[model samples]
Target: MPIHSKLPDVGTSIFAVMSGLARETGAINLSQGFPNFDCPKPLKDLVYKHMIAGDNQYAPMPGVPALRQSLAQKYRRLHGCDIDPDTEITITAGATQALFTAITALVDRGQEVIIFEPAYDSYVPSIRLCGATPIPYKMQPPEYKVDWERVESMITPKTKMIIINTPHNPSGQVLLEEDLLALQGIALRHDLIFMFDEVYEHLIFDGIPHFSALRYPELYRKSVVVYSFGKTYHNTGWKMGYTIAPEELTREIRKVHQFNVFSVNTPIQHALADYVNNEEWYSALPGFYQEKRDLFVDILRQTRFEPVDCKGTYFQLASYRTISEEDDLSFAKRITREYGVACIPVSAFYVDKSDFKVVRFCFAKTPDVLEAAGERLIKI
Candidate 1:
């Protein structure tokens, strides 16, 4: 029997591959975008408390009312966006599901989605699964800024949506207010929908303010904003996230969401209801991660890898060109097997798997783990 696959060419994720390699060879694993440190104990305790109080059942199809209410309050307090939780917020298993559901529900079979390359691995696959074409706009190194002219030029009648991520993955680049305004103008002119990935919203550094899609009224009306509790609390394993959209858009997303996992973990939803609004914890994240980013950058400067300016997220890109002319994947594997340091090849993020002689290193680990990885890396 012959079985065709929707994603036939897709192999195992690079994160899994490099992490596996690190495990097998006892290398320092910095390939995946996850913290080596444990999540805050209070968050864990809150989950336990909810579980003990009998919150183990399925959550509401849209999400727990209390949790949604907390989120509504949060948006109002932080981003000045007033949301009606009942019609606007739906918690998903993670940010990935929210993105998938939105793409599937809104996009037609022949439509196109514009995604910037060296993108998050999930975006292209999600777009392809919808029978939608993904248009790649290649952004270069040192400054992964969006070329709005090139982006607008790519738009056709078939172009239905544009996906944007701030505090971006791998590149660690962020879209500023001016950038968002440009995007807003484009979306309004073209009547395009937006899928805004802001999971690393709090992880921005050097006092850079995160200009969320929520801030743009015209864009927010046609956008689904994605966020992750796991990214905030250093607990990616938990896989908790939510989406925000207008009532009509939310209606379509919930049509897909109701059957897809039905709802997120009830106990976690209950736990988050009590804990999500801790202004102090989220407020202090930028400075906390900035220290780690600075330490990692300083260490890499002494070595062959030249560190790029990392504006946001815990990931840092390094130019390995000074030491080796080898392709990124081969170089990444060589370093993991030989030097005992694991990093993700930046090419894996591109549709062409474009090698720019750069690789991404996760700086989300604790000082001791980072120091240990640094000590080994400097020797090479």
Candidate 2:
């Protein structure tokens, strides 16, 4: 009756923990990274039309041809890179599954994967499940800049992959062109595969253009770039996402992906194929989220918490050093219970749970919800 857990150290995700606590305490839950508003009605209508048109069954093992082709065209228009839908693109249940499948396929047992912290929670566990080791490089606060020189110094013969996230979660920092160039050089020099998590690609702000790995030939040659339709359309629950890679790499990824989920939802895939063709829908995302960022920042100015510079993504980090010496997790819980506002402790994103006296709040809610959360946050 004794069961040895593959993930013995892992427990309930902090998102679930905080969200459940928020519900119990009647706090305004901003701990999880999801929109509190509905996606466009037109998108919903498209899904209805597709389902009614009998797209409810299993999609192709790779994906529906229409959705893959649309994504291929999207890559061509956005990154100026031509992708073969039949050979290079595959849709998954979410970006998370694509990440897992890619890692599972590429990372061999006893190999090593270098990851930067504070990373998204899923990265480490996925790497561990592959029977590989994760070599973590800590990026400091106030900037979270990667020291490429230091990164190269940590490389070893056993190192097989490097993972990166842009418009990063909890921190919201984006990678610059120089970072991409450095990563390209390193991956080529060591013959290491690179995985780019760009789920928040469209949420960049302040006129800063996103730098995709697809932009560089060297990086794209040895990279798997993951994207999320759920994140893009503000319907995270739909769990639709895809990955782009070279034909060789994608062939390997599909080996795992076929057994993983077989394919994503057929109706959602059909609807997304039609919806993505409209440039107007996605083009406005940066400006849309930027307004929310600016509004949230402006409101936080009324409080003691110092807001960090958020270049992209809908999450905002605030240092509560002036008000509390308590660790981030404790402060997060205290505020949730007493102030009726819930946020994720940034420490939870790090493997060590390193407390930097910072907490992350999701600002992707409605203006009124943000206003209400701001009122509670300001009271602290």
The lDDT of each candidate is 0.93, 0.92
| TM-score, one value per model | 0.99, 0.99
Candidate 1 C-alpha lDDT tens digits along 1-380: 99999999899999999999999999999999899889889989999999999989888899999999999999999889989999999999999999998898899899999998889999999999999999999988978888898899999999999999998998999999999999888877887898999999999999999999999889899899999998999889999999999999999999999988889999989888998899999999999999999999988988889888999999999998888999999999999999999999999999999999999999999999999989888887
Number of colliding residue pairs in each model? 0, 0
TM-score of 2: 0.99
For model 2, how does the per-residue alpha-carbon lDDT over 61-149 read when each residue is reduced to its tens digit?
99999999999998899999989999999999899999999999999999999999989999999999988999999876778888999
Candidate 2, residue 112: the lDDT equals 93
| lDDT of model 1, residue 223 | 92
The CA lDDT at 375 in model 2 is 90
RMSD of 1: 0.8
